[model samples]
Target: MPSLPSAASAADMNQVEYLGLCDRTAVEWETLRNYEMFSLSPDGSFPMMKASRSKAVRLADREVMMVGGGRCFRVSLSNHPTQNKLQS
Candidate 1:
């Protein structure tokens, strides 16, 4: 296993592990601002985010690698996200 000495490095490593799961669920929504949210896993294995027409649905679901509904829990976002104020 890889070693992470610094606190930041340790946190980053954990995020990678959380992302390297089997599957995740999400939805599309509209937002004024744009940002990226990677999984909080140690392995950090996820598809790179890019510019797109639709917004991403921020979700905290279970990793496909494990089973059962109560196995996992919700984690915080990569960073603090600002709410998009849309004009009608």
Candidate 2:
């Protein structure tokens, strides 16, 4: 007989897959606007924005690393836990 799958494992897998989709979307839709950067998640769940005249890197679903004007900035997606913080 085949073994049953665990609910926790399934949930974890879903999260991983979702994140991967987001990553891929970021790579696909990545663009520069007025020296700023922007991208949309594959599923259109959210949008990531980078400051103008700056470089940005997505650290996760809710985190972004940016650099510009000789300074580094850490940006967070709205409603994220670290949204209140200026830095990561």
Candidate 3:
């Protein structure tokens, strides 16, 4: 079995992958909102912007695994007030 990445490494990888995805999709990273949906591949080679509605309950139950820069991350969507975090 593979070991999970440390929190710092995971965050770093997430930032890098997020930036790459933004560039590929012509999205401004600084302008991304919490509600935006991105369809990321397991290898993070092809990232597509997904259309999301305003249904918080439905969105909260979805989880995605994104891999990039030789790192893998489990991203969970949540509608809980405390779970919302601004990633910078």
Task: Please say which candidate is ahead in lDDT: 1 or 2.
Answer: 2
lDDT of each: 0.31, 0.40, 0.34
Model 1 per-residue lDDT tens digits across residues 1-53: 98876766655665432212322533222221233333323333333221233
Measured against the true structure, the TM-scores of the candidates, in listed sequence, are: 0.19, 0.23, 0.19
- Which portions of model 3 miss their true places by more than 4 Å? 1-18, 21-37, 54-88
Best-to-worst lDDT order = 2, 3, 1
Off by over 4 Å in 1: 1-24, 29-33, 38-44, 52-88
Decoy 3 TM-score against native: 0.19
Residue-wise C-alpha lDDT for candidate 2, range 31-85, written one tens digit per residue: 3444333444344344445544454544345465554433222222343334335
lDDT of 2 at 14: 54
Off by over 4 Å in 2: 1-30, 35-37, 53-64, 67-88
